[model samples]
Structures are given as structure tokens and as C-alpha cells.
Target chain A: MYAELTRRSAWHDVLPTVLGYIGIGVAFGIVSRAAGLSILVTLATSTFVYAGSAQFVLVTMLVEHSPLLSIVLSVFLVNARMMLMSTTLSTYFKQEPLWKNILLGTFLTDESFALGMNKLNYTDRKLNFTWFNTVNLASYLTWIVGTALGAMLGSLITDPTKFGFGFAVTAMFIGLLYLQIISDKTISLKLQLTIILFVLILTYFGMAFIPGNLLILVVTLLGCALGVILKHAHN
Target chain B: MPTIKFIFWTIFCTGLATWLTRITPFVLLKKFTLPPAVIEFLNFVPITIMAALWFQQIFIQQSGQLPAIDYLNLCASLPTVISAVISKNLLVIVVVGIISAAFFNIVL
Candidate 1:
């Protein structure tokens, strides 16, 4: 394990995520601090919870003084995507010890998972436990560090939106999705685009009545079922 | 004012919930083999999830109200999406997004 950690640094593998996470973590810290959270509370949430999007939700809920139960439910709903990602990435670790897999669970953000999935799809190399741990730990620490910085300087950055920091993760996701689609040979680009368009329409039309997270969960589930049916029909 | 006790409780609840979601599949699916169709579906699920994420960011939806297009977001995102298509690099796309957003803010 120590050898793999020193082999190549593998820093390049997680460099992009590091950049995005810093911006996001700072934005999160700014928001949390702006919401009147002390620096200690902001750091505590960022360090312990570490769900990027859910952290945003927590800040908003804190501002509103929302009930604890609803806040927990909101966190669960937003982070449920991790369940899907964790399950999908599980087979990649069949050879590793259970403790390693459990340890890896700490670093499973969307960007890291996308990077991992892309690595799996586009490369011939096997998933190295050390490499993933490095990626996970580096990204995780970057987020915490950025949050600390932001919380420390939160009063200075009174307006994060003016710098368009809000769109950072969206852009990252778009880039990841674009890479995933272009690199994937198993799925047709046409089919994938179709699903995207379908989901966008559903989201735009239904978001008025449904919560965004809940709507996404439902749409993804139904769309996947439909995708499977279509795949069979085409075959 | 929110009390210190309430805030800590909220944090603990959220931390526990998020950890549960992350740990559930890892612990439960060790012996299970997912069906091939389910696997096929999972392949396409990411696209839907990504689409929802992008659309959620791009649109402005008030609670219990019709969604409206945020033209500024659309304008800012256009270049980033284009860069994503042409470059397919995360760093480049993010730079393009931030620059374009700033540019749009200035020009429009």
C-alpha cells in the first residue's frame, strides 16, 4: 500500500476534482458562515458530513430554522445518489479487504465517482486501492481546507454568486457527462442524448410540483426502466 | 435565533443520514448479483441524473410555481457546454464557465 502511494503520485488523476472541490467548498463555507454559522460549526459540518450539495441544503435549512427531522430527510434524499454510485462501484473492489471498501466510502463524491467510472471505462488498468484512497483523501482534504479558508474569510466574500461560483459543479458535471458519453462505446450517442432530453423535459415540467431531488430520483429510476425496455426492443 | 443545541442535532442527523446512504449498498450487496437488465439500466441512469442536475441549475423554479428559464444562466452556461463538447476537459470547462459568466454579467 505504501509503495503504491509513492509510485507515481497519481496526483493528476484527482487534480481536476481538487480544483472544483476547492471552489465548491469555499462557496459552501461562505454560505454557511453567511448564514450565521460560526467558523467551528461550518468546519464541523464540512469535515464530518462532507456531502457537497447536501451541505448547501443544510445551510439553507439552518437559515430557515427548519425542524431537525426535515433537515435529516433532506440530507438523505439529496445524498441518496451515493447509494447508486456505491453499488455500481462495488464490484471494482471485489478483491480488496472489507475494511478498505468501508474506508473508501468516506470519499465517494459525485466527481470522484465519475472520475473513477471514467477511469474504469476508458483504461485497461485495474482500480488500485491506494490510488483511489489517494484521490479520495486528497479531494476530501481539499474540501475541508477550502471550507476552513472560506469560513475564516466568509465575511469578505459577501457575494459568491457574483463570481458565478454557483455554476462550478454544474460545469464540472457537464464536462464529466460529455466525456462519459463520448468515451462510451457500448451506448449509442443518439440514445444517450435522447434520454438526456427526455429527463430535461421532465424536470422542467415537473419541478413546479415536485421537489428537485425527489423528481430527479423518480425520473432517473423511471428513465432507467424505460431505457432497459428500449434496449431490448432495439435488440 | 437558532440555538447551539439545535444546530448540533441537525448536524448529527444529517451526518448519520448521509453516511447511511453511502454505506448501505457496500454492506448489503456483497453477495448479490444485479440482473443484467438492471445493469443496463444503471448504465443509462447517470445521464438522467446528470441531466437533472444541469437542468436544475439552469432553470429557476420557485416553490409551487412554474419553472422559468434563467436566461443569464443559460447564457453563461452556453459557452461552458460548448467548451465541454469541444475540449472535454474539466479544468477548461470550469474556466470557460466562470469567464463566460463574468463576461455576461459585464456585457448584459
Candidate 2:
């Protein structure tokens, strides 16, 4: 049964996820090291937090010697999307054992969530915690390994910023967006446009007065609300 | 304040904040099933969130200046988009983006 599920997963879908984790994981490690964090801290965050955007936000704030409030707020803002991710998984995996659901929910990063949803659609099977665990095992391992490598060699590798290492995360998002676009053109376009506008407005506000993290929260909530309206109107 | 105090506060706040946010959905959803309307809305959440993130990374200004166009980023991103469209290969897209970004950075 396990082998069959692995075989059923489109390697094409899994490949982007793995590449994304590696690239983004390395970026986080480099930034963490540059922030003066020990390798242990770097690995701990990557392993425990397991959320790329949040890790980056936390490390960046720590580097600036921002107050504890800022670090907490930044991570919360970046990871607010997890609320949505876990909600969807809950509905899909509703019948699964409670313990398993909680375990899988903790591992629900962006790529894993996307992959899990896609797998569910392709297989037309109920996604239990077991399937989630299998897919997430690969993701978690890659992320930890990539982050550790980056932490160890980050200082040696000069000019990470100059190399556009930062864009690795963006590129991964774009690639994932492209996949969404191809999968469902109409809805994805609308969602993409709305988010672009929201970001532009939020960034403007963030630059003007509000903190960056607060701006992110405001924009994301607004976007989520708008998306709900659009979905309802369409239906 | 001492550095140790700062670290302690950072860890405390970070840990608390992380735990609260992580637990919110699980706790809420366990008791109640989300309505279909909510579920449908959530479908679009990831796409929008990611778009916002990508936009900030690609377009946001670094220095304290008006949004000056980074022609290099634009040039690099344009080709990256093309490569993504043509090849649809993650590795190829990454290579193209990196090379283009590097080339433009050197030239400009």
C-alpha cells in the first residue's frame, strides 16, 4: 500500500517541492548564520518551525536586534496562512484519527499542503495521516539537511544577496503559481490579481507608517475576505 | 538590558507566539466543521498569499528611496518567466533566473 501511494504521486509535482525546499532552506540558513545565530539554533528553527517564510522573518528580525514583540509578530504574520492550510486539511481529513490529524497539521507547510491537496485530487482517495506523513517525511528531511548545510557554509559563501539567493523563495512561489494557473486558469488569475494589488497597497502602507508585519496581516486578511466574496459571487 | 535577557525574552515571546498561532486552527477546526463557503474561500488563500510574497521579494525597494526600478531584476525576471513558460522545468527556470540576474547585476 505504501509503495503504491509513492508510485502514484507524480514525480513531476514532487520535484518542484523538493527543489523549493532546498533553495529556500539554504537561503534561510545563510540568513540565519549572517544574523549570528549558532548552527544549533539554525537547525532547531528549521526543524521545529519548518516554515520557510516564518524562519526568514524571524532570523531577519533577530539580526536587526528587533524587540521580542517584533520577532513574534513577524513570524505570526508570515505564518498566518497556516490557519487556512490546516483548515483545509481538517475538512479533507476529517474522518482520520484525532492524533494523526494533529500531527499532520503541524507539518502543513506550503509545499506539503499543496502536494497533499494535489495528491488527494489525483488519487480521489481520502487523505489519512499516513499519506501525509509519508510525503512530509521527505520534505522535512530535505529542509533540515539543506538548512544545516547552509548554516555550516554560509559565511564561506560570500554575497548570498548579490547572487539573488533571496529570489529563490519568490521563484518557487511563481513556479507554484504557474502550476495553479495551469490547473485552474480563471480562479487562479483572479486570486493572483487580487493578491498583487493587496501587496502593493500593503507595502505602500508598510513603508509609510505601519510595521511590515502588521501590514502583512492586514493585507492577508483583506485578501482572504475578498476571495470569499468572489467565490460566493461566482457560485 | 543584558543580551541574555534579550535572548530570554525573544525565546519566550517567539515560543509563545508560535505555539498560539500553530494551535489556533487545529483547536478551532477540531470542534467545528468549516462551512463550504469558508472552504471554497480557503482554496484561493495560498495563491494570493504566495503572490503577495513573490511581489514583495521581486519589487520591494531596499534602500530608503522611492521605488526605483531595479532594471536588472526586471530583466532577469522577464526571462525567467519566459523560461518557465517554454520549458516548464523547475531546474531550467532556476538556472535561467540566476544567470540572468547575475548577468544583469554584472553589466548594470
Candidate 3:
């Protein structure tokens, strides 16, 4: 019965997610510790914030003793896309209970959300709130464990940078980007180039005028607007 | 900032970020239906935003220097991209990319 139940569940999708989360979470923990955050704080951030990129940026800023407002602003900007993520998820999860939605919403990191969405597409299943909760719980547990390990071993370890562990997050992002490009029929090379150029230029200028996090916000929103206009014109 | 102060600020910012972005669309769309054009636009937002971020990470730098043919990144990225194109396996491509990047970084 247990095996049957496990087989019926979407644990297959959950395995890759666990691996990805644990690897990335360990990297975040190491970076956070190296940035001078205590293990407690590292664990807390992973437990509460649960946003890897934002957490990394926050730690870097804290180490620099950046202004509080600036730190907050940067994190806010990096995670602004979470809004879009939650919104896309809501369409799938509308029929689920409000409390469940809110709870699951907090755990909706990029990787889990993307995995859940793709799974939904493949199964052609309506958003099953139970399945989402199971996937997220598994991911969250793995992340916390990985974070703890990284934090504990952070000081003892040497040359993580030499190993390009820092780039693991970037590699994950690249992998996710490749998946999106391949899966979506509507995405075009020209459109991709335009957004990339716009962000690079905007980021260059934004760093001068706006704070770091806010710069991400401005660039992202501007990219969204430009994409919309370009797509509209094309069609 | 003190550690405690920074922690508080981080939490506050997390709350603000969560509420502002996550709640806005639901509140706006719950009562009102967005136009088709807007929905279509929203569909592309994820891919475009992600692409912008990925490109920026790979190509851009903060030292006021242009990304002038990062041979190491290229060497690593070439095999990575090839694996991605041919095999289409996420794990394989990532392993190849990281190994190549690290090997090149150490050697050259």
C-alpha cells in the first residue's frame, strides 16, 4: 500500500527538485557563512526567506554594511518576479483552499514553481493542491538540510570559488532558461536578444542612479513592457 | 548596520516584497478580468525575465569592462551548450559545463 501510494504520487518529479534544491542551498549556506552571517541566521534565512538569489544578495550587502533601505530594496527587486510566479500559480491553484494557497505560496521558490508548472502541463491535470504541498515540503526539507550542512562546514572548506561552486546557481539558471526556451513555442531569438540588451544597458545605467535591488525592478519591469510592445507589433 | 538591525530590515523587506508583488495581481484580477492582450503579454514575462537575468549573469560585469570574449567561459560554455543541444539532458549539460569551466579556469 505504501509503495502503491508513493507510485501514485508525483515523487518522480520531486527527486530532481530535491537534488537541485540541496545543491543550490548548500552553495547559499556556504556563501552566507563566508559573508559573516552566523549559522543561526543562515538557517533562519533559508527557513523563512527561502529565496536563494535574494538571500545571496542580502548576505553580500550585509557584509558590506550597505544601508538598510538599500539592502531591503535589493532583495525586494530580485524577488519581484516571485509576484509573477505566484500569479501564474494562482490560475492553476484557484480552486484550492485559501489557507493552503497562502501557505504554499511562501514556499514557491523559482525551482519548485517551475517544476510544478511543468508537471501540471505534462499531466494535463488541473492544479492539485495536495501534489504541490508534497513537492514543496520535500524541496523545503532538502534545502534546510543542505543549508545547515553548508553553514556548519563553511569555514573548514577551502577554494569553493576555485571549484566554481558559486557558478552552480548560474548553471541552474542557465539550465532553467534552456528549458523555457525549448518548451515555449512563442519565444523568439530576436525577442530574447532585445530583453537581454535592454537589461544589460538598463543595469549599467541603473547602478549609477538607482540602488542595486531597485535597479533589478526597473530593468525587469522595463523588459516586460518592451517585450509586450514587441510581441504586440509582431502579431 | 548592526546584525540585529540588518536582520530586522531583511525580514521587513521580505514581507514587503512578498506582499507587493504576490498580492497585487490576485487582488487586481480577482474582481476584474484582464484583456486578452494583457494575458498574452503576461505569458511571455517569465521567459523574457529569466533570459535577461541569465544573459546578464553570463555576459555582464561590474568593473566597467565589457565582456570581451571570455575564453574560459566560452570554452566551458561551448561543451555545455553542445551537450544541451544534442543530449537535452539537464544534469549532463550542467556537469559538462561546470567541469569544463573549472578545468579551463585552472589550466588557462
Candidate 4:
């Protein structure tokens, strides 16, 4: 796989993803710093976790002093869709080493998965894993570098609240939520999504009196369970 | 302040869970087909989790209480929501959000 992964090949196919990841990664770094994470923690989270939206959520939880279990669970649930994405993309994998496939799975972001799937659409039986690996490599490197750049800039602004960077994560989440809703076009689907959202929001607001340790975990699990049941009934 | 150990554990756990999500399908389900119900259930998780997170951030205060109105955030969210609906670009939406929130903080 490594033999054919030329720099030219990776960049040619993944330019858009490279640019997109850099932009999002920079934003995550700035917000993570603004939320009071040390530069080291910011780098560690981005380098280790590599899930953009979940990183923002984790930063928010850290800022607010949410319990550790809650933070982990929330991030997990947010990134869980990777399971489906990875599964779909794995179907087209050629007979590469199992380790390579597993390693590649670790790098699977939404943008990478989309690009890989689009490329896979052209092949009949023998899929090209190296090209897709190049795409992942490009996206991954840009993301890490962009975050480092943003963290440096974020460090300069001592009072992040003054620039409203405190609200950056919320803004990002809203945008993502809007995209999720608009992507699904059926009236019934929209209705179900709305119901699920409403129930989750209510649980969050209603659970304020509970102990901190149980609040986030219970609400998150409850919300997910409700969503699953709702989908079962609707379909 | 959070201890180093707590933060480390949080990061490690999040990374582990995320890795599991990314790896399980490739390893365990390569030759298997997931039930329709299970797939449907997974489909709904993203939206629900995000909505919970969004509302929690916007509506819940630091003291674990809901305010009468988070006026600044609510006002800023108007632009964010509008740009997201119209442009559907992540960069644009984030820029609008940051600018709107900053503007409201300055003006009001």
C-alpha cells in the first residue's frame, strides 16, 4: 500500500478534504483553547481523539467541569456514526493486511469516508486501498497541523470570552445539527428527528437537580434509547 | 482545576471508545450482516446526541440551572442558524456564529 502512495496522488484526490479538515481543525483548536484547556491538552485531544465535533464537546465538558464518565460517553455517542461509515467503506477494501485495514479504520473521518466511498463507486471487484489511504493521510496531517496553528493563535488571546469564542462550540454544533436535519428530506423523518431532539433537550433541562455524575450519563443514554425506539416505530 | 490523571483518563477513554466504533465494524462484521433494527437504531444516535449537546450548551447555565433566556447566545444563534440553513457550509456557519456572538457581546 505504501509503495504507490505518492504525494501527488494523495493531494490530487484529496485537496478539498485537506482544505476542509484544516479549516475545521483550526476552529477546534481555537475553541478548545478558549474553553480553558491547556495547549498540551488541546494537542493531545486532537492528536489522540481526532474526532472534530466530539473534541469540541469534550472541551465544553472540561470547561464546565462535567464528570469524566459523562464527557467520555458524550464524545462516544457523538462519534458513534463512524461505525456505520467504517462498515460501509470496509465493504470495498481489497485483500490488504488486516492490520492495515484496522489502522486505516482509526483514521476514518466523515470527509475521508465520503471521499473513499465516492472513489469506491467506480470499482467492480478489486478496490484500490492505497489511493484511499493517501486521502486519509492527507486529511489527517492537515487536521493536526491546523489545530496546532489555531492553538498558537488562541494562546495570544488571553480573554477568549471577550471575542465570543466561548460560544464557538455551540455555534458549530448548531450548524452541524442543521445539516443533519436538512440532509434527511422526508416529512416523517423530520418529525421523528424533532421529537428526538425535543425529548433530549427536556431531559437535559429536567435533570439539573440530579447529582452531576449521573446527570449527563442518564440523559444521554435516555435520549439515545428514546431515539432508537422512535426509529423502530417509525420504520 | 482538573487533575492531570482525570484529564488523561477522559482523553484515553474517549479515544478508546471512538476507536472501538471505528474498528468493530471492520473486524467483527466483515462477513456478517447487521439486523435492520440495529442499523436503524445507530442511524438515530448522531442527531440525538448532537441535539442534547447543543441544547445543553445554549440553554444550561454554569450553575446547572436554566435561565429565563440566554439572550446573547440566543441572539447570536439566529445568524448561525440562518447561515447554516442558507449556505450549508461549515466554515461560513462558524464564522457567522463567532461574529454574531462577538457583535452582541459588544453592542449589548
The candidates score, on chain A by TM-score, as follows 0.91, 0.77, 0.76, 0.64
Q: What is the TM-score of chain A in candidate 3?
A: 0.76
10 residues in a row with least lDDT, candidate 2 chain A: A1-10
Residues B1-108, model 2: lDDT tens digits: 227557556656665566556556776787788887777677666666655665555444544544445566667777777877887665576667767766777787
Model 1 CA lDDT for position A8: 49
Candidate 3, residues A1-235, lDDT tens digits: the string is 0112133464665664465566677888888888778898889888877777788888887878788787777777778877777776676666555666676776677766666544543454355766777777788899899899889889977445466554544455566566655655555767866766777676555555554445455666777788888877888
Segments in model 3 whose C-alpha atoms lie over 4 Å from true places: A1-10, A186-219, B1-32, B63-75
Cand 4, B chain, TM: 0.62
On DockQ, the stronger of 2 and 3 is: 2
The number of residue pairs in model 4 that clash at the backbone is: 0
Interface root-mean-square deviation, each candidate: 1.6, 3.5, 3.6, 5.6
Tens digits of per-residue lDDT for model 4, A52-135: 778888888887889988898888877766766676666556256677788789888766664443333233323456776777
Predicted structure with the largest TM-score when compared to the true one: 1
Stronger candidate by TM-score (1 vs 4):
1
TM-score of each candidate's B chain against the true B chain: 0.88, 0.75, 0.69, 0.62
lDDT of 1 by residue, A1-235 (tens): 1123331444766776676788888888898988889999999999888999889998898889888888899888988878888887776786777778877776778877777766655555357677777788888899999899889879898777677666677777777778777876777887878778878878887778988767767777776776777777788
Best by DockQ: 1
Worst 10 residues of 1 chain A by lDDT: A1-10
Higher-TM-score candidate of 1 and 2: 1
Candidate 1 displacement at residue A31 in angstroms: 1.3
**Candidate 1 C-alpha error for residue A1, in Å:** 23
